[model samples]
Target: MLKIFKKYYGYQWLAAFMLGLVLPFIGKLLSVSGLHKVIWFYLIINGLYTLYLGYSVRKRGLSPLILFALPAVFSGISTLLLHLVSHQYGFYFGLMYIVLSLFTFFGDTRDDPDENQIPVENGFRDLKSETKNDGQVSVDGNLKV
Candidate 1:
């Protein structure tokens, strides 16, 4: 479960978005209003998630570009779904979430520093040794933790 969480560490808000979509239908079975009161709850949860995402990305020295357009695209899809279903079900929350996500992501403008890329090697050998110009395998002298 933690592995899944780490793999999708930044996409937890999409779960909230999906739950918001399902809430109206779930309410019908529970004898509750079909999402009339849940919009605020949805926004609050996603807003908190957005705040954490913003803060963590800043602290981790990540590129804003990595987060750029992610919330926009998801919120855009949510907004489009809202347009399709809101009139039929009568709850509108997508616009405000989009605005909040836009504010959080757009305010971060720091460029990512250049990443040091490790050269890829494909071989059955367990040791990390590169072939020298003289066609002899030599161990990499540099050790990294």
Candidate 2:
């Protein structure tokens, strides 16, 4: 599964774009009575798409981070601004998606296994030492050679 994801993860965004284009009609069809219902459906679909985009990008180490993160950040802010202007609560779900994306972008370093790793030194010692000679301690609390 990881191998497949590593190879074809790029396709996920394109699929998401297509899915987004089709979501409004599906929402409209699902909501036969109320505009609010349709908007709510749209919000859920859009939020899921944003989450999918973030996850896909986070999973792809070879891909450029800016390509996904910039659009997501801008889209999230725009969605919030749009909701503010239009006074629609359904669109507020976009903010949640944005927060999810930000978390994935910053927190998910699992894509690159070595990124979080630190090499160990064979005989490393802390520079700050409490060693004293004749009750005279170093001013910086480190042993002076």
Candidate 3:
């Protein structure tokens, strides 16, 4: 499951964002107290997780600074907004999660293998040894193979 965990690290961020965005509503529906505390805890955990992933990718020469920064900033802003806005904006928060997810997906380049590392032999190959220089092979006399 570790492989799945690594692959969906971005999704984890989305889920955390969703949880933080909805917890207050859920708590209100259930008449539960301390919703803010729960949401804050969730945001804190997810924010730290994002930072960890960013650090890991950065260590591998992929700059995940923006990925980390945006979420960290959003977490603070959204938490504050959730408190100030009486009307729940969970849907908008979800939209923000999707936007963040897209950014994370597009921003990451570590998932792709280096093009320079691909072996030449594994690329286009000539059927005949003589025409290897031309990158095309000639057949029989009339066929120009």
Which predicted model would earn the best TM-score?
A: 2
Indicate whether candidate 2 or candidate 3 has the larger TM-score: 2
Off by over 4 Å in 1: 1-5, 8-14, 34-39, 54-85, 88-92, 106-145
Candidate 2: where is the Cα deviation over 4 Å? 1-10, 30-40, 62-95, 108-112, 115-145
After aligning candidate 3 to the native by TM-score, how far in Å is the CA of 140 from where it should be?
4.8
TM-score of each: 0.38, 0.43, 0.34
Q: Which ten residues in a row have the lowest lDDT in candidate 2?
A: 78-87
**Local distance difference test, per candidate?**
0.47, 0.49, 0.48
Instruction: Write model 2 residue lDDT over 1-145, tens digit each, in one string.
Output: 7677547654654444444333433444565444564445445555566665666566655364433542343244333433311225333444555665566656656666676755567433444566654354588897655
**Each model's total of backbone clashes:** 0, 0, 2
49-131: candidate 3 lDDT, tens digit per residue: 55454545544544444354334433554546655223244334434544544454456566556734646767655444655
How does model 1 score by TM-score? 0.38
- Model 3 lowest lDDT segment of ten: 84-93
Clashing pairs in 3: 138-145, 139-145
Q: Kindly report the root-mean-square deviation of model 1 from the true structure over all alpha carbons.
A: 11.6
